[model samples]
Target chain A: MNRTTELHPFSVPRYPSGNPAQRVIVQVLVTQDAGQQRHAQLLARADTELRHLALPQYADEAALGEALATLLSEARVGVHLELHGDEAFIWSLCGVARAAGLLGDEITLQCNESGRRMLFCVHCASLQAGTCADLQPCRQCGVMLEVRRHFSERLGAYLGVCADADQPYAQARP
Target chain B: MSALDARVGETRLITPVIREVSLMPVNGTLPAFSAGSHVQLHLPNGKRNAYSLLSDPGDTSHYRIAVRQQAQSRGGSRYVHEQLQTGDQLKISSPANLFPLHSTARLHVLIAAGIGITPFLAYCTELLRRGAAFELHYAYRAGLSDAYVEVLREQLGEHLHLYESSARRLDLGQLLGHRPLGTHVYACGPQSLLDALREQSLALGWPAARVHWEAFAAPEPGVPFVVELARSGRQVAVGAEQSLLEALESAGVELPNLCRGGVCGQCRTPYLKGDVEHRDLFLAHEERASSLMPCVSRGCGSPILLDI
Candidate 1:
């Protein structure tokens, strides 16, 4: 339906607009209470052919991982993905999408939580999730981490290393 | 870093279509670089092209690159193949790496198609020196193309596998199956190859962190659009093959630019109007609300109004 012309998959102004695919497969991932209403709304927007996969409201980081794996394996390539949830949940979805090799241009990441986000580590790089306050906790072999920036494109998690070693605590500060 | 003078040391025909061009800096030694580093050469036609360094990054004696002559000679490759000679002095940008190897991957899986094997040449060197666990799987048309097969086989030995013609179809499911927890895959080849690898890696549940790729060619040249300069009120037509940055330059308008490929953020310009198709990775998502990287980004509906 010439959908590509109106909204470039990964481009900004993502929707100047286009027609929804007939029998289009839309995946709606719901994670938090605040995102439930939007999740329902997104479901209404999709056609009956839309494939649905839902994570429990209290789904933790691991559940998000499993959900993403299902999405990558089950979601038809070139189909649209609608992520309805909090920043952490959204990041989790993004991390999974990335691991499954979905490019930012390939899917739509709709974050329900607009507030500043704090990412949960999968503990893949280091099994340490988000318990520490500083970017660097003398815990990981003298390595300092910058909590907010340097997101891993593939993992969808923010890379927690101090981007600049000289200024180790930049993320901790305002 | 600014460009320095280099002479074409030696050039050889690596394959039916690929030419190996060796470059040596006129002054002292060239700067040391990492495995996936590439250097840009300024051609006499005023066009610049970046090529991955195929020589050992440790020995800066001279840098080597494999250039494949495309159906469309953008003048850059043609200049190197046709006019450039052993004694010809050329200006080359310092080596820069947008595709650096990950320092933490436990097991590395390298995949390539045709000339996509260029960057991995240097990577094999460093990986071997560090005694890293790695394997390279290559695919090519049976008799059509295979750039550095001999060299890779000799160095990689049993570690390298080549799939010719009908078997060239990569079974990514099997390749990415049961990957160790920290295994990482790097693919540089045709967009189709990268897409397949990425899809299978993701489907098999590989962490996005470990699926690395570098495009064999530049980003797709987008649809034709227009740019209206606010200062002079001049209109410039940007062709599909041309970027906003090039169109403005052709119109005698100049903006700061470094790696014309959009790695360097120097060409960003404030925009006053029109929907921008931001194609670059340089600017943050929010930054695009007010500005754009002219080198890669373009206008969608109407002519983009630039503050320039």
Candidate 2:
């Protein structure tokens, strides 16, 4: 016999009828090795890996879009992919229906490639149709690149995610 | 498992079956415990209740806990104080320490109000045995109605200050006036007293970190709010209508809570983000910025985030 427990009774409601389109913001952090002088090569390699995997296709857009009709259903989930390096890379992949541009929704990911451990957001979505240009500089600090490398050799790379456009990335709060 | 059993022993009536009931390990192997450690009592009815260990840690023959019958209690305390027998065998969890005595301090000031004296009594015994400098301020109603007065007086002697609040009030400011520097103040009492002590201690320049506290009972419930469990991604509605603990329990979050009254800090979780109207008697004033007791406190506004 199976004893199934209903963890939550309340469910997310779908968007109101005739409501406007919605958008979601995404962020990613990529770390690069200090020994490697060519940062662009590393980024290109990662972009290739992301395109090859195509998580958006794996998620089954039709089913996910149906689920997104629920009010509690989040449009995007944040993903973090960490690489071995002293410099940390951060990326944001915002998913917006072509009609809604950007709706101030954001997701964060923290990845540890060495430990093979990754943390992902449950309610958010990954980008379905967007190029690398859609991924701009850090939204919060306006840093030029996705990765922020510290001068010190000891400190490793880190990533952050946020929902508000004004405050895109926040440092981890204890 | 054996080690846990060895620590909790058998149940015995330290006073009488109806008034005061005590449980000790039958194996005579009570674990080495600190001043404010508590044990989980597995009653004959199969329900578990956490009780503060009230005896000297050095005494291995038995581990003692006192139970008072609450007329309206949800049966845990009522059963132990009313229905349980002197020699009844009870399955008990090993001793767990949350309200531990600070050993680093040179002087320890312990303040207990009403039944909150249980943990301090054990601390007194340990301090006396170790020749540690300590003072115990016990506040309770006057007359023969006060429990453990005789034993406390006999054991603590000059170190014990009995403030019968029924006749006079406990002047916290006056009592704490001469408190020496580096004296660690530990208090466990009613919410009003704890709140007053917390406010006055900070006003008087006592470092917020040095003051330690524990609550003996849950605070009165207040208005409820919606709580968003960050991990499960579920929004649980909680308020004065129901406790946060009950709300979470109903939502199917398995919180390892023993005393649902906020006395034990077992259910403590990090406040990822949100405003909480704290109703618990535990937690020093300064600590409130970082921690909260979900058992009694309710969210003040929408979507109080919790890292449970």
Candidate 3:
């Protein structure tokens, strides 16, 4: 029961604040759903001091992942990330941001979801795409997995396991 | 103190399913434990269950724990409900905290759900004593049970927000509003609630450092399996309800462990073979591939070849 070795960014000394000339913030806006238009507008109108590289509605969400890396590679120490868009896209971008050594405290995100999202299977250790919130056949293993609220950080998706282990043919609720 | 001897001072049904048991030291005062500390009770049924210290951290006179009769009782909760009573002497491990509050936070956001409210009871008291700015948000399905809501309501007062689960869900988005720098959030509750907090916190751009969680649920039981001590070459059969720690200890092998709930990495051991059903939160992604916590974790099937 010793202390966890998970590094906390809060404990790390702040990398200096309030120098707008030195501070370069990266604004990653993945405006996939039309519903996210207002959020995009808000981020654009919110601040004008910091220079931004706005990536809006990339052809594919996966393409935005590569763009995030290039941005972080060239990003300065004072650089912060502001993510505004769909939940899935924002989450993937957040994962990308995390992979690039950006902590949650150093970023700003306004996220929205459209019900169906990508989920990771904890049992099969695979990703299931376009899965709804309700009970459905697991895309990977066909275990009739129920998407549980358990989210695995490593997998970057909600953990879905066998829904009805006891009963063979019980209808699951949403 | 060797699993400090304790007598159940009082066992009251705080709610129909939730039983609040007060444990008094057989002698005088017990060792001091901070808020968020929990004790592992060695029940007569040979099952060890970890319960959060529901009493205030300042008070060392006695320890209190609220045990909810789990729907899927694996003997521990059932034993506490049906067998345990006042004056019953029970063996309990020294208090250990896996969910200790961060020392310095400009603002504390405490979230709890159902029986998970036990840990926060002590946290709320400790925060109030220090006059720290904090808030406790307790989520519950109405009419099910109010384990510590009434008590916490009186203690937390204005700082408590009771979130009810229904069609018009408590806007978790609004619940976790604009983060103002040094706001550290601690959550202890069901996986659903914790998962939402974790996903939402990140979505709202809260750092992994500021967001902390305590998975206080009883260890999910796996199938009966065997353990092979690699060094000694001894094979021990673990029963369906037995933890690998208990099985190891039963076979006269001493394994160091603290916070048997899997938060502490004390019992984490490297495994040579077997598919480990890792139920612990201690091991990181990379470590989980190789190691398993024997306290709350178990092998999926077959034999777990431990490097112990």
Candidate 4:
């Protein structure tokens, strides 16, 4: 498909001149349900602790981690958290939080696994594994999670590696 | 409505009831109707089924419709074709038209596949009555499967073009090229045929508003999303897997809906906020900004707040 023609309003643009190291910031707003309240509490607690943690300059790992913790903690109440950050950091933090038992069992993770790029559902607690399927409200709980991304100038460093991964495609003649 | 009452006021079996029977009735007292008009037949079991009127509008008392027995269908078509005799009565409603004739064009182009030919047959009838310029491209899997072929051939003569897809595929692009300027195109068929026609028309720069469609059945709904009733402050979670209308209906929200496939536009509601993933075939893209067909479209990532 032609990228230009298939472009939707939410699609990210190709940054030709931008630095590869920069990361994007995403904001996720999670609504709480009975099964998700615990996850929210965990996230709130992690956010409080991580806000004071010292991390690399231009890298908001501390904030990102806190967001993950908040999301994971809410998993128990069926509350889903949205995370916005560089793709890599979001995946890593989510993985860590899930491993830490902050994220619960009902939540399913769907991802490309190889590409590590896709949308995540807080309700299902699952990453979209391959192509995005139809948007669905959570069946287990009624809460909906909204995901939005904001590219921050300060978070640019973390994006450098992934941005370079696609460099070879730019060199190919169209 | 008596079980013995003929659904159609007038009846004429134009063709003998072969393996599959077809009927052309003279609809007495039935009001004049446009293309895509259908009449509801009340069955003995108290259920109703709608069949498109296929006869010419000029001929009063004669409304044409063809029926094929489906082994799995709820027995509407089978009863009409197999059980109901020519003189038998069927309880039918007055002619109602959800698919109206397009008035914005000098030339009308019609494409019909299989049983989809019913509406176009009526359209051609109206066009012939008005002496309007129009072209009909009818495609069928087999020449024998083309119901009413003899009638169309005798009536339309050179104006009708029939193609057998079993021999070759219908070339929509070629047909589009020969279409007259300011022509309005109407198509009905299986999703694949309709999809192909839509894609080719869009690629050829046909105005989105100029293309009309009516799907036989509503396609399955995509993933669900959350719907927040703004006035009632009732938040309901709907899966992309099921239609919001269906979900709401199951939840006991009484929303008026007809032809749930998105043609009637009766299920439209105000969108208070949030993104809507539109899938309905009724309104043009511009109409989507304010209202949505809750029957088909799903909400995007966020919770769609609706006035209803």
Best by lDDT: 3
Report chain A TM-scores, every model. Answer: 0.51, 0.15, 0.65, 0.25
Per-residue alpha-carbon lDDT of candidate 3 for residues A29-142, written as tens digits (9 for 90 to 100) = 334454355444545644422333344545566776787777676553334666655445566677787677555556665544444456776667778564445577766666
For A116-170, candidate 4 gives per-residue lDDT tens digits of: 3344443344443222222223233333323223222222111111112243222
TM-score on 0 to 1 scale for chain A of candidate 3: 0.65
- Residue B166 displacement (Å), model 4: 2.4
For residue B32, give model 4's deviation from the true position in Å: 1.9
Per-residue lDDT of candidate 3, residues B62-130 (tens digit): 999989898888799989988998999989999987889987576788888888888989999899999
Candidate 3's clash total is 1
lDDT of 2 by residue, B1-308 (tens): 23255323345444432244455566546667888988777655534566788877888667778775554555667776666776666677677777888765667888888778888878988899989988888887655326777888998888888888777677777766545433678998767888998877655545454578876653354665787877788888864545777667667775776665666666777777888887765577877776788777777764578876
Across B246-267, the per-residue lDDT of candidate 1 in tens digits comes to 7776777777665676656777
Best by TM-score: 3
- Scored by DockQ, the top model is 1
Kindly report the docking quality category of candidate 4: incorrect
In model 4, which runs have C-alpha deviations exceeding 4 angstroms? Answer: A1-174, B1-28, B178-180, B218-262, B267-308
| TM-score for candidate 4 | 0.46
Docking class of 2: incorrect
Model 3 vs. true fold: TM: 0.65
Comparing only chain B with the true structure, the TM-scores of all models are: 0.86, 0.72, 0.93, 0.67
Please, what is the whole-model Cα lDDT of each candidate in the order they appear? 0.68, 0.55, 0.72, 0.56
- DockQ for every model comes to 0.04, 0.01, 0.03, 0.01
Comparing 1 with 4 on DockQ, the higher-scoring candidate is: 1
